[model samples]
Target: MSPTNNKKAMCRYAGAQNQNVQRTALPEIIDRIVNSLDDPECFAHIGEEPIHFSTSVREMIEKFRNILFPGYFSDAKIDSVNVSYHMGQEITRLYDILSRQIIHVLRHDCLRYDRECSECERRGNEAAFCVIEQIPVLRQKLAADVRAAYDGDPAAKSHDEIIFSYPGLYAITVHRIANILHQRSIPKLPRIMSELAHSLTGIDIHPGATIGERFVIDHGTGIVIGETSVIGDNVRIYQNVTIGALSLPKDAGEKLRWAKRHPTIEDDVIIYSGATVLGGDTVIGARSVVGGNVWLTRSIPADTKIFMEEPRLIIKNQPKETDSEGN
Candidate 1:
């Protein structure tokens, strides 16, 4: 064979081999392996719900705040002439949206054992409707919360400032909302509300915690008020305060189950920062003060002040005289 013919033949052979290699490897390389048996359900059924609903809840909270405090959070163009009308419209819309979302969450997440009985369903509907009807009362509670914030914070310029720019107010707002749902026994809504606040404010206040009016939480980060914790009126808690539990009830296999664990803070009390008041029986009495960085596990008396004092160290030397008379 001639040199030119041999070179052309070799070049064609190499091109053919490369084309065969690409064809064999491309399908396996780009193909996706989906486990059909693992997730046979749709994405909505298999995957968790989107967390954007929590963001929506936050937005709804902001809207409620704007409704409560006009011109502070909402558009500044609103004035006395049309403020009421605008607020009414906004509140109605918010109520509709919130009701639908809450109902959806309840139907999906909460176990509905009463749905079989007609009477139970009727009562549940009535209770849910009644709680939804209490938005005005919730608004009144929020007003009290704003008052509490203003009263507690020395640097607060006005009620408007507290309403517009306070994390305490935000946490209390979520608590009030969750408290209402909890009282209504609409499951899952309250936790969602509390957790939404937790994500935003770093304050985990269980909805089951019965908090009275005029409760203020100052610098609320790392503050945990557990379920069954009852906080009284005009109570103030600083950051890193934990109303927690000291013990747990274990099952037969020693697995810890949910139990009532937390403290109760009575009226007119002040719990300073980094204080831990634990145990279900630990009751902080009314008009008492708990100092910062104190760990309390016992109940305190009313009108008592508990604080930390520095410990004294003493060293004593035994007398060397009298043991050996001769020496």
Candidate 2:
């Protein structure tokens, strides 16, 4: 070995050792910070020692994708001979993961509602089974969604490509699975699942939202479907659409907490890019076509087409100026 290289390596080792020695952190300050955090006034979890729900949510989503599209999404090489065995094994694993997570969440919820903690295991099992039992139905609904995408988008070459490549379908598939959990009243996990999809696709559909079959979102980025949004079958929405709340005064408070905040989009409606449909009472009627960049609030009649008038664009060439370097 070269002496120069050995000295360089020795210097790197000495620098690492120096950094470790320099990490003699202030114990007293850390203790004070810990004490401060332990105070109930400072931290909500201070008085409570709950069994926190911890699971591999990313892995859970992957498994969920596998379950939804058996051959396409699973880790294993699926064929007719091994398909049944793989599905059963994967489902069983998913069931266990969901059951554990559900119990953790249900226990916390029971405390909040002053319900019996004893029912956690049973309730969690029921909820998990409820969700699992509906996987076929969910797959059917997702198949409709995939079909919608394939039929609606001219860019899509095939249903297989749509399933494998489309972000909207991925988000919707996750939402469907999470929606089932949300419907069963299992908390936290649903939102977590949806948010995972949101992070992946930049399409935010709250799990609480009621979305029907054959729903499609084309160029789905910047789409926001709020908590109470109700969507019907064969509905197609484009990018930058917000089916969200019309804001209320701050003092409205918990009185209006459970009240619907988002719009009800009926069957066969088409909402285009950059359209903002706000308020619970604001209904985009069945078969209505809302054009791009339209701002709608009130209820529209069925078979109506709402769009903004095209504005004239006046183009003027700017005078060219030289830079400081006289380019």
Candidate 3:
């Protein structure tokens, strides 16, 4: 090799060596940080068996999505000729991935909480099968959701557009799947699924929320549907809406575990943007319309339209620009 090339390679090797030395110099700090993880409250599980991997969970979700909507999210050609074969293959793959993840979650909980052995492997397989069996019903519900979005939004060009690009639909899709697991009382996994959707769509929907069919969320960013929220069929809500619980004390988590803390929107209701409806006793009755920026805490009767009084505006034009005195 040429002398110049050899010298440049030597310099690169020296720089890498120097970086390694600098990284190793932090041994004391690294030891302190590792020791700090001994705190029981810390989220780290040092020396314990590894928990369910988020990447694996995400892959399972994607496979499930492909199963739910064939040919939409996948690269493979799905038609009448090979659709059944494709579906069967994808379902079997999803079942494998999902069962493994379920085992990890159940085992982690069993060990972490000092709980009795629940035969995590068997239960995981059963849960995976259960979720798989309900895909047909889930597909029906998703079809209704897609139709609702297309029917409700004027800008929606087609059902295909809504399914492919709408964040609201994506959030709802994840929520529906997560809700099934939540109903089965599968711990950790459901919340993880919901949070994955939340992270992607900027929509926070708790898996515990009971949302009915034909439900629509338009421009769903900044929307929070809390645990125990009961949303009825054909309900539509817009962006920045919060169907949440009233404020509670520090021990609310324990105190309100099974409590119906969030508001209920009856069937055929429409809640517009920036509305906040809070409290367990608060129910927006059937066919009601809640206007934007309305902070509601109490129950309202059916067919009620709640809107804020129009604010008076004071418009003053800026002083006309003055030309130079000579002009």
Scored by TM-score, the top model is 3
RMSD of each predicted structure: 11.5, 3.9, 3.3
lDDT of each: 0.78, 0.88, 0.92
Q: What TM-score fits each model?
A: 0.73, 0.87, 0.92
**Candidate 1: stretches off by over 4 Å:** 1-52, 110-132, 249-259, 311-327
The lDDT ranking, best first, is 3, 2, 1
TM-score of the candidate numbered 3? Answer: 0.92
TM-score of 2: 0.87
Query: Where's the lowest-lDDT run of ten residues in candidate 2?
Result: 46-55
Give the runs in model 2 whose Cα sits over 4 Å from its true position: 1-22, 39-41, 44-55, 111-115, 318-327
What 10-residue stretch in candidate 1 is worst by lDDT? 110-119
For residues 178-220, write the lDDT of model 3, one tens digit per residue. 9988887788999999999999998999999999999999989
- Output the number of the lDDT-best candidate: 3
Query: lDDT per residue, candidate 1, 76-110, as tens digits?
Result: 57878987788778777777656665656555543
